[model samples]
Target: MSGLIGKKIGMTSIYSAEGTVAKQIPCTLIQAGPCVVTQVKTTKNDGYEAIQVGFDDKKEKNTPKPLQGHFNKANTTPKRKLVEFQFNKDVELGQEITVGDVFEEGDFVDVVGTSKGKGFQGVVKRHGFHGVGGATHGQHNRQRHPGSIGAASYPARVFKGLKMAGRTGNKRVKIQNLRIVKIYPEQNLILVSGSVPGAKNSYVIIEK
Candidate 1:
């Protein structure tokens, strides 16, 4: 599948045309593309087919020597991000593939990103386990404790793969079938229908 690289731009709510109330979707506004095809690979030349693309400009002084060589080969300025996607063998080098080329309004897309980190958490909040019973029954500060483990004799050790409190979030996640609310080709922006993973300004891959 072909996709585009974009930066998340927070979220906001918008109203629909019908009078019926609907949950305003929180979306990540993305500055999608103006991506330049830096290199095109073919089975005869590289043993496979793919197109290497570059996006977002970077200061010449900030770019390193190794990457500078890459940009020079394409006869373009240094870009902050570079990615490759499989495509037809006929794609040409230096060709520009904008956001408008890949997606359109009402299209279904899958967004891939890293979710927000939540640090260490308790079982009640992490695993959704029921805590201890009432305080009236002599249950002290053990209200949020993991009441019991198992039988004293039959299973002395805790079971493996048991849900427990620990670290959470900050992992790769994919939200599938998100509606493409709008597409602004002039500004290179894509308005998705709901919240996506990752923090603001984070990179996300939008795939069809």
Candidate 2:
């Protein structure tokens, strides 16, 4: 599947010109490629079919030495991010891919990004577990506690993989089948219907 790396600009609402009256729709704006192909992997050489593309600029002093050599071969400046996207078609080295090249209005795409981090959380907020007991009914401070996780003497040890509270979010998430609402080739923007994961300005991959 061919995809482009994009940064989530923000979210906005637009009116749909359907029927007699117009209805407002929520859309997330993204600044998609203008990505340069850095490397190409073939099955015979790399055991896969993928193309590595680089986007965003980084100072030469900030880039690593090995990666500097990699970007040097591509004849492009240091890139902030480089991602390999599996594509069926062949693209030459140093080729540029724009948002208009792979996607258009009315196209359905899957977005992949890291979700927002929520830090440490309780079971109530993490797994939607209700509080242990009510505040009243002779209950003191047992509310919001994960009561009785394991039997006292059944296995003599706490079971593994318990859904206890801990750090949450900040994980890779993919929202599938998001419809492309609009595309602005002039400004290199893509508008997708509904929300995708990750915070604003974070990078996300839109795949077909």
Candidate 3:
């Protein structure tokens, strides 16, 4: 399936044409496509079939020399986000792919993005730990603590892949099968129902 690189433009409510009171829908607005193809990979040469698409305008001063050269080859300006997506059909380099080419209203699509970063967290917030026993039971400092980490006189060490708190969020996340509420081709916008990963203006991939 093919996908488009887009920027999340926050969210807003979408009203129904029927003027029904219960038909108001909340959706996240995304600025999608009009992406330019930068590279095309083949099975014989690259051992795969995929097209690299670039989105969002980036200044040459901010882009590295090598990447600038890459954009030069595409005959387009620098892009802020570049992502490779494999398609069933073949696509040529420097081809322009827009949102209308792949998606339409009421289509189900998956959105992939980087979730917001949350530094150093506890088990309660990270792992959904129910805080030791309860709010009472004389919990004190052990209320939000992760209890019984290891066997006492046995292994004497915490097991690997334990749900201990360290870092939270700031990871690649994909939300699947989100319904496409609307598409504004003239404005290069797509409205998806429900919240997507990452903050406003963050890059996201919308895939079929």
Candidate 4:
């Protein structure tokens, strides 16, 4: 399955074609690009089959020398983002792969992205643990605390992997089998039917 690298352009609600009422869907607006094939890897040469695709134009002053050389080999200008995806066969170097080339409306795809960051949180919000009973009946601020640590004598130490408060979110996540609502090839944009992981303007990878 091949995929495209794109930037999330926020979300919006749009009406269906049947003139139905506006549906408030969690749509992801992505700029699905004029990407250039930077490198082609073959099974014999690289022990795998894949194509390295580059997206978004960058000025020469903003691009590093090493990457400039890389894009030079592809006979394309410097790109801001580059991602490699494994494909069944090698793609031609410098070939432009646009949104129209990869996907169409109603296609099923999985969107991969980094979820928004949430700071340190308690077990109730983090692990969904039922906190202590009540505030009126003797229990006070302890309502949010984890009740017990462990058994008394045997295995006295608190067990490892016990759910605890810590940093949350800001991790790579994938939402699978999302239906494609629309594709705007002229704008190089794709509208997905549901929410995708990550904050607005974050980069996402859409895979078929």
Tally clashes: model 2.
Answer: 0
lDDT of 1 by residue, 1-208 (tens): 2888888888877766656666566666887888888877778999988888888889999999988887888888988888888774455677778889899899999998899999999888888877986787677788788777666876688898877888999999999999999899999999998889999988888888
For model 4, the superposed segments whose C-alpha errors exceed 4 Å read: 17-24, 88-90
| Top of the candidates by TM-score | 2
Model 4: which ten-residue window has the lowest total lDDT?
A: 16-25
The estimated TM-scores of all candidates read: 0.84, 0.94, 0.91, 0.89
Candidate 2 per-residue lDDT, tens place, 1-208, comes to 3889999999999999888989999999999988999998988999988899988888999999999999989889888878989887768888889999999899999999999999999999999998888888878998998888878676878889999999999999999999999999988899999998999999998898
Question: How badly does each model clash, as a count of residue pairs?
Answer: 0, 0, 0, 0
Per-candidate Cα lDDT values, in order, are 0.84, 0.91, 0.90, 0.87
The root-mean-square deviation over C-alpha atoms between each candidate and the true structure, in angstroms, is: 2.7, 1.5, 2.1, 2.3
Deviation (Å) of 54 in candidate 2 = 0.9
Weakest lDDT window of 10 consecutive positions for candidate 3 = 14-23
| Clash-forming residue pairs, model 1 | none
Candidate 3, residue 133: CA error in Å? 3.6
Q: Considering TM-score, which of the candidate structures 2 and 4 is the better prediction for this target?
A: 2
**Model number with the top lDDT:** 2
lDDT tens digits by residue: candidate 3, 30-52: 99989999998888999988889
The local lDDT score (0 to 100) that residue 81 gets in candidate 2 is 79
Displacement of the residue 140 alpha carbon in candidate 2, Å: 2.7
